[model samples]
Target: MSFLKEISEYKDTIINRLLSDQELCKAVYYADEGFLEKPDIDDLDNLIYENIFPHRFIPDTTETAKTFVTISCTDYRPTGNSFKNGLLNIYMFTHRDLFRTDYGYTRMDFIMTKIEELMNSKRGIGLGELGFGGLNEYVVNEKFQGYVLSYRPVDFNR
Candidate 1:
């Protein structure tokens, strides 16, 4: 497959895995408003699905609150013959207040853990199993405080 196809497929896999987890969905919903009752599962799923971006996060001025993820292939290289390796960066963003709020430790914590559980070591099209590298704090504009989780192919020889 072409490199573009590989990256696209990898991103789709990540988004699908995230949306499939009910607990993660609930955590996202509660992240903004801890006191609000849970909404329907489908609604939560839609909310997450809509927020996930493939290569970029286009901030909407109309949005008063935002929580989202942006998936990007930041680096890639061919190992020789047909083999390849790359680094994938997944950025999880939430409102600064929501991220810092103490709702039994905050929902960003749960979201990050769930993302790691779903994505780490997962295989993708034209790529080896994903090995989580590390996570670092990322500031997305003034309203958002986020983390960037890095992943790379585990076995480059494949």
Candidate 2:
């Protein structure tokens, strides 16, 4: 399962995208928790190809440069009657997993240099050595601390 990648390996890929004219500031939206994924594929490819290839960027991203942005997955719930009635009252948020209620959350921060090195294959878990928990979440090795997140579920809507 080659899906996990190091966040630090995409520095030049990102910095270059940021400087391009394609506008890398646009973010990917996860309506549920209102999370924003920066460096959206469009932001990255624009630097090299001038447009997002195929479509939105996913966990196993392909386009470089655009991969430098942070993609966060968060959990949220209703806050008041308005929220319960679907009144668009986004009043609450937390570090919970959208699907993994017991273990759900995300922090996309990673080193710049690491991101560049990772852009080579777009395969394997973090650093190419880790485990993906059955729940489609990254499982940290007791000894290695690497994030094995290849088990990520497919986002059909994307």
Candidate 3:
């Protein structure tokens, strides 16, 4: 399978896993086109109180009403001289507050851990260890927490 296809499939698997929880059914998103404009405080309030769990800007590409987790390709490059060995980085996005609340923290942790497990265990996808090891933190204007993960697809020989 092509690397892009593998990435897409990997994303679909994650979306399915998250949606298993009824609350998160429509909370996940894929930000392939880039992020939506930052909403004003008024809009933020509307999105939050209106039962909009996941926040999103572009309703056109987003699957659900709100956006909880946004997945995007961070980086893709060769790890070795040959194109056979390469590293793929996928960034998972969510509200920073999720990491503060007890329930949210646990749920977020579960999702992240599950993603790593699924990637490593699924031989077909060829996901290897993260670029470093654990989750790398990134914040977007105090609103979003981006967890950047590094993975190596299995070599063709393997």
Most accurate candidate by lDDT: 1
Question: In model 3, which range of ten residues has the least summed lDDT?
Answer: 30-39
- For model 1, the superposed segments whose C-alpha errors exceed 4 Å read 30-37, 43-45, 61-63, 100-103, 125-128, 154-158
lDDT of 2 by residue, 16-121 (tens): 4334422222311222332343334443444332322221123232322222233222222333442211110001111223212111432222212232233323
C-alpha lDDT of all candidate models, in order: 0.70, 0.25, 0.42
lDDT of each residue in 1-158, candidate 3, tens digit only: 56445556544554444444433322233221221222223322333323322222222322322234444443455555534434444444555434432343433454456556655445544444323334676444445555555565544321
Q: All candidates' TM-scores?
A: 0.81, 0.18, 0.47
Model 3, runs deviating above 4 Å: 1-67, 71-83, 100-107, 127-134
Better of 2 and 3 by lDDT: 3
Per-model clash counts, in order, read 0, 13, 4
Better of 1 and 3 by TM-score: 1
Clashes (candidate 3): 4
lDDT of candidate model 2 versus the reference: 0.25
